[model samples]
Target: MGRFEGKVCIVTGGASGIGAKTAEMFVEQGGCVVVTDVNDAAGEKLVGDIGASKAAYLHLDVTDPDACQAGVDLAVEKFGSVDYLLNSAVKMAPGMLKDLSLADWNTMVNIGLTGSFLMTQAVGNWLIENERPGSVVMMSSIGGRQPYGMSGAYSTVKAAVKMLADHFGIEWGGYNIRVNSIVAGHIETPLTAYLKDPEIKRGRSEVTPLGRVGQPVDIANAVLFLFSDEADYVTATALNVDGGITRSVMNHMPGRKWS
Candidate 1:
């Protein structure tokens, strides 16, 4: 039997990129998935491709608290219960701290941080009321840990997300709820599609210990492990799925091979 044979997962931002890949993985592993995203066309197409038995699409704006709760309601109404939540919705607004506007910062935080919190709360509450064990996986970025001058708002919100996972994990442990964050590295997704340039791609690969950028499947696989019973004991941890880019700082020195 598949690892997630009897599971039901709610995946935010499931229209594309890592979220889409993760939702696909969940269904492949025998789970029913409620795929939520702002992109109705892509989301609906994904549900059609995955089949109605295994997947359903919901038009969700994660920043809206009511919408987040409604997503949980939809999942329960269709799939019976919510077993997992993948909070992957994000808004990437890259800007240096000095020039970053308050509006951009708020937008980023509202989507990335507050949106995640709302979803988590909604799902967490459902699990608690149902007396079920569950897991939550948040999508964070390498920028959250390292100082990325060009991604001030993104980095700030991601960092907060990491801590938010820790806080939720601690508070929800008594209820058998696991919360964790995935610190993604340079992955080739819609979000990072611009890095397709040879120079940029090569530069990224040179710095990563794995010698290449990550694919959506890589992050999806990691999330699957966390969602399954295999990670029953894991919680409040930030797993880095970034090809060791975060640890290869020395490789970027002026005369180093990577440089």
Candidate 2:
């Protein structure tokens, strides 16, 4: 049997990028998935592509409490239980803080940070009510632990997401629920279109200790591990799946080589 033959997962932002890949992986491993996203077309397409029997789509804006609960309700309705959640919904507004508009600031914070919080609570509540064990992986960024340039509210929201995971992990541990943050690196997603520039991509790849940037599948693999029974003892943790970029500070120096 596949690793998750009898499991069900809910993936926010499941239309594209890391979320899409994660949803596909879950279904491939024999888990049913509730794929939620504001992108109705893409969401429906994903559900179809993954096979309707194992995947279902919902138009979700994770910032709304009702919407978040609806996602949880959908999972249980379609699949029997809500065994996992990946909070990958995010909309970035990049600009210097001094020039950041209030609308942009709120959008970044609400969708990225509050969205995760609402989904976590909704799913966690359902698990508690049913006396079930579950796992949640919040999508944080490498920027969370350090500065990421020209991302006014994005970095701040990412930082808060990590702490949010930590807080929930502690409060929900007794219920056999695990909450953890996955700090993303320079992933080549639509959100990182700038990486399309060969010069920019090359620069990023060179700096990464692994000598390459990350792909959606790379993150999906780590996420699956966290959601699997293998990680039963893991909680209240932040797993950096960034190709060792965050801790390669010494490699940042010009002409530096740790090889």
Candidate 3:
């Protein structure tokens, strides 16, 4: 039961969704988790619910390098070392290039892309300074590898994060640190709960070979493996957690109806 016994982890955006699920798994595996999010209320509540002994919520804005460093420092102070870093904080704005505002684009890039870089740099520095081998799991999206027209900013930023991981893997491999990414598909999370349209949901399911949506735990399970010794040699790879949907093409039949 204690796969991560005595390990410490830092999960950005750990207030909910995949981050929360991952933190829960880490705690269950005997890893102490530092849960940080801009959402102080939810973050505190989540930490409280997860139990103070296993998790602590820290107020953090990943875009702020100082805050990111502080979060990492807190993790080390509390748990001796930070063995895992999961960059899962993100914001999605759906709009075509023409329709999207520059401000919106900047926010997406800053939070999704720059934030990841900052967190990695800060936490990575800590791990290196302390001479501790660690693993980093970036929560990228399948949309990063494909075109989701209205999601230009998010797509661009995610793709950038993926590349960042690869670069980190190469640069830090000498220190025994591993960096990898997960390209997740349509997982049923509070972030996507707004996709209330039944038709959209059906289409999402139909496109996936598994004929269903993914749960947060599905992604968490993969993150656990990546951070564990099982994946000690795995790095610089974007593992897809999309229910085999990435291989299938959507049917584009006009006026076609299926009962």
lDDT (Cα atoms) of all candidates against the true structure: 0.93, 0.94, 0.90
- lDDT accuracy of residue 80 in candidate 3: 80
**Model 3 local distance difference test score:** 0.90
Candidate 2 residue pairs in backbone clash: none
* Tens-digit per-residue lDDT, 1-259, candidate 2: 7899989999999999999999999989999999999999999998999999999999999989999999988988989899999999999889999899999999999999999999999999999999999999999999998988899898899999999999999999999999999999999998999999999999999999999999999999999999999999999999999999999987667884667
- Give residue 225's lDDT in candidate 1 (0 to 100): 89
Give the winner by lDDT: 1 or 2. 2
Residue pairs whose backbone atoms clash in candidate 1 = none
C-alpha TM-scores of all predictions: 0.96, 0.97, 0.94
What's model 3's TM-score? 0.94
Candidate 3 local lDDT, 56-148, one digit each (tens): 999989889999999988998888888899999988777999889999998899899899999999888988998989999998888888877
Clashes of 2: 0
Residue runs of model 3 more than 4 Å from their true location after superposition: 250-259
Q: For candidate 1, lDDT tens digit of each residue in 89-120? A: 98777788899898989889998999999999
Residue 195, model 2: Cα distance from true site in angstroms? 1.3
| Two-way TM-score contest, 1 vs 2, winner | 2
State which candidate has the highest lDDT. Answer: 2
